[model samples]
Target chain A: MAIPDNQGGKRAADVIVTALEARITSGELENDKPLPPERDLMEEFGTSRTVVREAISSLANRGLIELRPRFRPIVRKPDYGTLLSATGTIVRYLLNEPGGVQNLYQSRVFIERGLVRDAALNATKENISDLKAALLANEKALDHSEEFFRTDIAFHGVLYRIGNNPIFPAMHEGFTSWLSPNWARMTRSDDHNRSVYLDHKAIYDAILERDPARAEEALIAHLSAAWSYVEETF
Target chain B: MAIPDNQGGKRAADVIVTALEARITSGELENDKPLPPERDLMEEFGTSRTVVREAISSLANRGLIELRPRFRPIVRKPDYGTLLSATGTIVRYLLNEPGGVQNLYQSRVFIERGLVRDAALNATKENISDLKAALLANEKALDHSEEFFRTDIAFHGVLYRIGNNPIFPAMHEGFTSWLSPNWARMTRSDDHNRSVYLDHKAIYDAILERDPARAEEALIAHLSAAWSYVEETF
Candidate 1:
């Protein structure tokens, strides 16, 4: 394969990535297959050892390949860590934009509704205990604003864990953590507090009762109110 | 802060990352703020220049900071590239597991249904036309598998763009591009051709008809059948 000139803001690493990714995605470079030696890749790509190392390192960081000492790098599938970090980054962008947080309520509503539905379907006795623990902690730490936020996160984290899907917990964690302190203060108003607390309680109760439809409805109601608050405030 | 000793199998870069991340996450260091000079940081962390540069580079690559020439590194808000790269990593992982293709169907159902719902509410005539063009390309490329898949991706891409949410398009692109082709071929059977084609037609009709509920239902039904096929195959 002819190596394209590293122009157009493309670097050696990008060249390697584009080539290797195509091969991997095309099924020509199957999983667990050892890649060409660094020297061989260097010659093929017509780059220095440093460039090849950077490319491989980048791939390894993404969990696309594993580099073992004294052996050729091996391709591995990516994982949840990659997704969590990526989602967190995206949510952070939304949080930073003007009026972005105000608009996020719709996306948040959809995710929470799905999460609550799964939680209702999958919540076991142990999961209930975990949820209760988080709720109790939240109640106890209400006076300590930061701790209150932490407990609040714990509550939602437990809910996602109980939902039986790996993707939701990370998304929840990333979104909540990225916007905690500001949202916590937003919830401090008397009207926001009463409405939010009640909505959370209703959703929690629906989960405890193992009613998927009710759980979804309660979560949606909660988010609708929350979105209204955001709209009015922002 | 006490500097943790780096042992065998851990590089100075890893140590620097752990310490810096702890400080950053704990709010000892503020977001969007610049770090101390490299010389000063190296002195404080008791690490080498190479180690400090590697640490900062890693952070920069992850969208945590931006390295400026002749100046301190500035903390950055999360950027889109990082988010896309991260999601690609997650899809890569999902492709590695047994019956991984089915999980993609689950994700598709969860994500695309919501995407099309919002798209129906938000899409412009220009966006709808772009989507139609993509669908036409998909139809024409039916005999060429690679071209068909590429156009299939473009079709979804147009839908995501129509949703007018930055998060969804980045995520949709990452998942589509990073997914394993072997896993995708599971749905390439002739039996699915008629069902998928008709579902796409219905979805297109709903979009053109500007019926949000019908659009969502059509997309969900399409994904649900895709999931069913995956389950049977696996």
Candidate 2:
């Protein structure tokens, strides 16, 4: 098939994708329903088998549909898995370029700043306790040395979970997963971990106090300090 | 070949992806070079033709490699295209859920807040003038409704460009593109457009004055006003 000839396949696929995406979003195609067979789609779009196939692939790429080998493709209720893969892919690419990782880090700061602010404004008391528990877990793990950092991450995860939208946690976790390698490379001095723990505590405290500005400030300070350590180490 | 089963294929593809990704990122395999043939990969990984082919598809899906039939797949020096697609994909999904679009909007705020802050701190005189010209374009286009909003968007685009890292602009543009459909639907009264222009001018003036705090505040105010309009209209 001459490997579908990139540009041509992409153009045809884009056409199919736009049509299908509109259908799916407008609820013309119900969620979790199977799409028509390739033969059917080929006839409907008045395109070749290769054109139809490429179009299906493009829709799959956009998380609008799922393509299975033997069965017809289906509309997808896609989730953070798609988000994580995309974020992870570009992040790895960015790590190789100048100021790339820093941009990623800056983006994380931006995301968490907003998340922390929202958590403070909207979190219930139950959510505050969860944050406290996550903080305690970090403190307990600090003695173990090996598991300390993960619980620290878990603390932020808990804070993110306080918001009504689940994507906040998912997005935060995605960046954390991508940044974990370099995270591990940083020198975690006993004092560093201890200080980090305190930073998380202060953030929790700010949220508990229902202080949005303070929560944001604490997060920015916490991230800035951690970033400084990374800079000094690397 | 029974469409390599999903989860099983995913596992196998992941293994291949990890190995090949390491090779590519490590520069053991240079960018733009064709990956080893499927037959070679099959033998190298001790996998079947179906398994190797599926693995290659996953790499291509992640934009790490591009699959070409009848020839070896090639390594991709992937760009913002992949990242933009992925961001757009997930953002579309997020827009349908509760608090989803809000989270996305908040994310944009965080990013631009940082971008504007940096621009004020770091922008060159030339960058400031470019922003001034964009603001003027927005002002001039006000009479012609269609081009007006685009020039308004271009103003932020210019601010994003002031930063050294190009990804800031790419990421902002990606979010803007995804959010634009909704942006277009809003009732842009003459008064609304005039106020928005003033907001942009304030942001520009902040940057020119080298006031990071004012820049961030102006941006937040501008976005907040826009958000309120969207909320009331919808």
Candidate 3:
């Protein structure tokens, strides 16, 4: 159970991290269970408290454990949100690079084009009703720019969710976070808000009609117009 | 520049991290420049060596700096590769979850569909020639499964690079890494390899003809067939 002392402290902590990660991932250490006390971990790994603490911090950063202020770290299962948690930092960094915002926005348009097509071809009654509700909320919030923006995002979010895949929603959330700064900088007037709402409405109508080509066309047009607005700000 | 002592060691480190990060990202610190000596940082931030080290480590993790065993940490301007460095760990975790592989594969298909269409619409003469070279290499490597597999990836990779966006190539790398395990487990045969080669040829031909719809059809057909092969092993 002893870790090699010849290696540096970071390597020693990494060894402990790998061992504990295997246990947590393989379910040998059950979720919600407090990992063995720090003293026991220190003794068992033949490492100092600092090494053990570093290992725990590393695990927590990887979303494999939950650390509390005065308690042993508890094993936790990672979900999509936890899996994508680091994306925010990376994306924030990317936003600073030239053309980074446009590239990201183009990627969003590409993904949403597929998503809206899927919604048209595969949306169920329940999905349509959800879209309707979102559309209504968007319409109601048209006069309130901040509310309108939230509901506007919500309406497009429904398209991402229509595929019933967890990855898409997480991706959509990432896009929203990454692109919001540009969207926020755009000059938002009643005319712009109304245009965006109508674009959403057109997308919804195409989905309701179950026309994949039309849905894709509407989505591209909407995103292209949105990009023009964002482009001006940039 | 004393950080509030009451906020604890972690918070004190974070305070130092924020100030250093601002200096680095604002280009004031400049890339490849050695950070101030640990003793100087300690005095400047009114913090201990451990706190300064922790801040340096955190910055390194976020791809903001490069750390060496005996040298001062140097600032790094993050690039696409560094920004996506964390994706491998998250993807490895996701592949362990039920349906994770298929979800990722479907997302790849969705992205590639858009990519192939873009390729058809916008590929320059040089891009087409690059793709042709990759295709020829793939054809030549057909007899060696390992080499063929690599060339096969390289051929598909050409499509990713055709768009001239750094993000697409990085994403293609991510999909390649995430999906390779499943692909590696699948049974490889001469017939299977030939079929995949033909699929690539058809996609290339469509792109050559400047037919977006035909290019997308070829891509979907190719990926669907590939998915079936993968599904059988699962």
Q: Which candidate tops TM-score?
A: 3
**What lDDT does the true structure give each of the candidates?**
0.66, 0.75, 0.82
Tens digit of lDDT per residue, candidate 3, span B14-62?
7898898788878999888898888899999998887787677667656
Kindly report the root-mean-square deviation of model 2 from the true structure over all alpha carbons: 6.3
Ranking by DockQ: 3, 2, 1
Compose the digit string of candidate 1's lDDT tens values, residues B1-234. 111112254666767866776566555778779987778889988987767866776665455665544557776555444555444444654666664555555665767766676667677889888878887887877766667667767778787676565666666755565543444757565445545667787888898887877997898887777556556554
lDDT of 3: 0.82
Worst 10 residues of 1 chain B by lDDT: B1-10
Task: Output the better candidate (2/3) by DockQ.
Answer: 3
Docking class of 2: acceptable
Tens digits of lDDT, candidate 1, A39-102: 9989999998767766776675555676554567898545554455435434554566765674
- Per-residue lDDT of B38-85 in model 2, one digit per residue for the tens? 898889998876667656665776677866545577897666555765
lDDT of 2 by residue, A97-144 (tens): 766667778778867886787788788889888888899999887766
What's the CA error at residue B40 for candidate 1, in Å? Answer: 18
Model 2 spans > 4 angstroms off:
A1-76, A114-127, A186-190, A206-221, A228-234, B1-59, B65-75, B97-100, B117-127, B187-190, B206-217, B228-234
Q: What is the interface RMSD of each candidate, in Å?
A: 8.2, 7.7, 8.1
What DockQ does candidate 3 score? 0.32
Report the lDDT of model 3 for residue A181.
78
Best by DockQ: 3
